[model samples]
Target chain A: MEPLINVAPYTGWVYPNETIFEWSVLIAVYPYLTGLVAGAFTVSSLYQVFGFERLKPVAHLALLTSLCFMFFVPLPLLLHLGHPERAFNATITPHWSSAMAMFGYFASFYVALLLLETWFAYRPFIVEKAQQRKDLLGTFYRILTLGSYDVSDKALRYDQKWILWLAIAGIPGAHGLHGYVGFVFGSIKAREWWSSDLMPVIFLFSAIISGVSLLAVIFVVSSKLRKIPIDLACLKGLAYTIWGFIMVALVLEGLEFANIVYKGREGVEMIMEYVTGPLLVPYFILQFAIGAILPFLWLSYMIWRGTTGRALIAGVTTCACLVLFSVFMMRWNVVIGGQEISKTGKGLLSYQMTLFGKEGALMAAALIIAPFLVLVVLTRLFPPWEDHAKSSSSLRSHA
Target chain B: MKKVSNPSLAARRSFLSKLARAAACTGALAGAGALGVGVAKGASAKTEAKPAAEGGSFPTKDYDWTKHQWAFGVDATKCIGCLRCVEACKVENDVPRNAHQFRTWVERYVYLEGEDRARIDSQQDPVNIAASGSEKEYRFANRYKDQKVDKAFFVPKLCNQCTHPACVQVCPVGATYKTEDGVVLIDHDYCIGCRYCVQACPYGARYFNEEHGVSDKCTWCYHRITKGMQPACVEACPVGARIFGDIKDKQSPVSLFIRNNRVQVLRPETGNAPNVFYVGIDKEVN
Candidate 1:
């Protein structure tokens, strides 16, 4: 069949085939989705393993968010594959030398760690809910209990110890999840925009920023919806962490760009053309200016002024939303931007995201929305805020 | 009762072992049979040609892949922007007729003396050159009629068949690989269509075959070459521009050409170690 769209007009010279990019917006979303998963899991680790008491309010929330996003991480990948049914070949008959072959293993291990830790953290609650109900929901909770009704102090202590160990192990597993995504692009020596030793590092930090920012937004919105007083201290703590990581991510990105320009690589001119011309708005305006710098400055001002109550919440929420947009734009810039320059270094190519095609924006939006829909179901079944409510009620009864 | 001989169990075990052995034997025979067919086909194609005295037969029997590494060379000076080779490749390889798909294509580079870069345009199918018009005429129509031309030439591009192919290294399922004969090939059934190899290829030689649902590229006409026939592109080159032969054969014209000419490969800085060599390659060619 003829291409529904002709090749976008290109300047100078490009191989005829180079006019179209094989990897598209779906690929861009793949890394972004995984980054959210990695970042959320890391935030949970900060509370579970690092003994950070202030992060307690959002610990379970963060873990739930991670699980929700992790479940949908492979959707974009499958959609991007030309033969989605054959994707499992990469697992069963994997080529070890290929970095991409490691994806299945890495994702499996990380997801397993996430599931196990989430179950252990919520086992007591599941057991309590199982005994509290006598209907089909009770049966479901009983199954979730896995036939062990031990909510004894010893069992709980053991669960805590195990949760800690898993969280410790999960930190690297989380890093590997998103780091591998970055490595996929970083290892491609052909594309100067992606070929950086710092790509993985930048991916990890930005992932944390996006994750923390997402948590901050979810916490505020969920609290407002539930009519619970917002946790200002928790919001501040998360904002501080998000601010720190964004700075690091921005610096690393800057250094990577500086190094490339200083080295004056063969493809630098073409990349410069891409950055200055076609990609100016997304790369400069959305990603660096509004996404990184604006949020960083806003959060810094909020922290310095020691703002509290409504103003602190507004500041943190706005920054979180902005950073979230920035990270998404960053992914778009990296994946799609890298493809804009021709491999020949003498031309540029263009991509227009189709609204209805398989790899189109609509599909990407659906994939993004799928996790949040799952999050709603998960939140209903295993409400992350339930434990906090129970603990507070017990303390009031004791008083 | 417990000590009674288990004759039925023993019989079943022996039957299973026999079946396993039979399966192994069948597998080995099938592999050998496939290889034998390839060798027979190559030999028979040669036998069908006229005798060597008539200068029509290629020495297919003398060139065993285990001992001979095949290579290709292109003389840019001899190329005249005639896209017969491009048409021949598509027909031979069953490449799609769409403009985006090409197994082999030619680029015309026009360098204005003082400019650091050349003006280049690649025509997807040279068979339609008349419809598209000649490069000179197109340039003239673009108001470059009075522009000074330092040098102009055509460079035909295909899969470099790199010794250290990035595509091979990046394939998640080992679907795309290099054969011992130095031809890079894709196992269409095994390819998951991840397009990672397509991205890894520095020369932009690989493309996703929408019809086949797999990554596709020029295989140097592996099937035809193994059957002792010239690649369609090489055979269709009216000016003898493209040269294809086993480089291990010291007396082969391609080997002699490589020995005599200061040939170059495209994008040597990529360190792909491309087996396709070019003569009179301009600096402007990527």
Candidate 2:
């Protein structure tokens, strides 16, 4: 992608007691996003693996979404690298122990898994297109098929079997993938808030919360775009999953704090400067109130009294809330809470957001904005929603 | 060999030495694929254990340096209600004269206004002592009880360039480093302007040099120290509150002072192992 020019850095300020370098938000954003992608992919695998017909519509869409976002996940960390060129060394000289180091292998396998699934899922369609003519599209499809363009029933059966198997296997891989992102922060013994093993569990749950919620909304939006009627069954089905995950996430969030406070770790009292202090507003108001509470209410209302349309709208709103709040608070908490206590454990520090040059803010902007741009491009080219039907019909009526 | 006459004891010593030698050789061979910096095994350890330069003098071994790198140390006990060191560091580092952003400071906890509601807070814009500014430039009588400073202690702060510097370890490109002489320095040239070092620093000493597009921290004055000079802040301290020198050298004033005084690193548990030692540090400090 040709990088966007003139993307300015957001206004970020330094706190008196904080470090001179602005690292928390910029560093945390990438992991937060990867968590979302991994969470969504895990949900997608459920339909593929367990034969939930309700989730069938999103089977291809989920794989494509996972593929699209995974491509961008490594870039933020890359730009953050002091030496971006030498980043490949992360793979070649893998520090297998460090969670950050294992990102290379996870990324490689995750991408391969997604790609293989996409190819197999879309193969019969491509093969059908290849049998038709001698144009560039035909050549492209033929190349995609690797000359085994025979549209045999047996080949389709085999592809379906493994795609289902791969999806099942990919579920745990995806969960582990995002869990590892949490492990990066949780493993660091230095920081107080991030150093809990429960963090990975919390992150995993939140990813499912955000990912599935976003998928519910996206499916509705896309169906409407193509003039397809809202799938009420799927909407209800997704809400049940969302409720399950959201409750899990809320408990996990509470458990994380309780674990810390209960243990009375040396750093716990200091970080309360966050729970009841600087982060109190963002934590309760935005993250809990809007992100978790409102969504749960709206979805619950729809589940109980309202129709599929209302449920879809509520789910969509919840996804927006969850996405924005989840990313915002994760960054805010990491950046703000990380700096609250003094290294000497003497007193509290403060922070005011500093927005200025492209060095910090613009780089982060490019990271987030660029992914949706890729998603848009992918939609234009492949159109994840229509792949199965279009390919099948074209192949059958090729007389 | 053993008791000056026992052959069995002599044989035992020889055999033990031979076993140790073999074990060390095997260990080195096992870790042959290991990479970078210091070697981990016996033959290499022997090569590394070069016996601290056998003669009267070599570069670092014989150098008398307690006078240079061991910068300002505060005696919280004998602070005498002074804030001169804080002012001195501000002037030296050219820190913006802000109420919040302090390079050095004094925190005052007072049971003022009423006895029931005790409160604690730091005073960044400390009032200077008007008259005999010698050692009493900072007086808090008006701010506390008896028109006198309340239960207060003036604890001066500065970046403790740690032994195992967290900031240095997390820097992606090795931008932050400790000098051979034991002072930490930030190299702006190789810094890609990433603030990982800044965030990782337990002391919060490292800061993004926004003006320079790179991270900067208390250098212990690399430009000055290398050429036999003291840091600006240490030089300007009026009350003899600041002492800059090498901790390694026994003869240096700092080494003697540290040995004589009950010096304490700010946050010993952070694992940074700060080189900065305060003689009379308080309980709660970051």
**TM-scores, all models, native as reference:** 0.88, 0.72
Question: Best-fitting candidate, measured by TM-score?
Answer: 1
lDDT of 1 at A39: 87
> Tens-digit lDDT track for model 1 on A16-133?
7876677878888888889998888878888777766677788888999999999988888898787899776666446656889878778877888899998987887788889999
Flag clash pairs in model 1. Answer: B83-B126
Candidate 1 docking category?
acceptable
Kindly list the per-residue Cα lDDT of model 1 for residues B159-272, writing each as its tens digit: 899999999999987777665578787877668999888888899899888766788888778767766778889999999899999887898878998999999998888889
Position A373, candidate 2: lDDT: 74
Q: Report the error of model 2 at residue A255, Å.
A: 1.4
Those runs of model 2 whose alpha carbons end farther than 4 Å from true positions after fitting are A1-21, A24-28, A75-109, A130-169, A187-191, A260-281, A297-331, A340-370, A386-399, B1-74, B77-147, B172-192, B222-238, B244-248
Q: Looking at model 1 chain B, which ten-residue stretch has the lowest summed lDDT?
A: B1-10
DockQ of each: 0.31, 0.13
Chain A superposition TM-score, candidate 1: 0.96
Candidate 2 local Cα displacement, residue A133, angstroms: 6.6
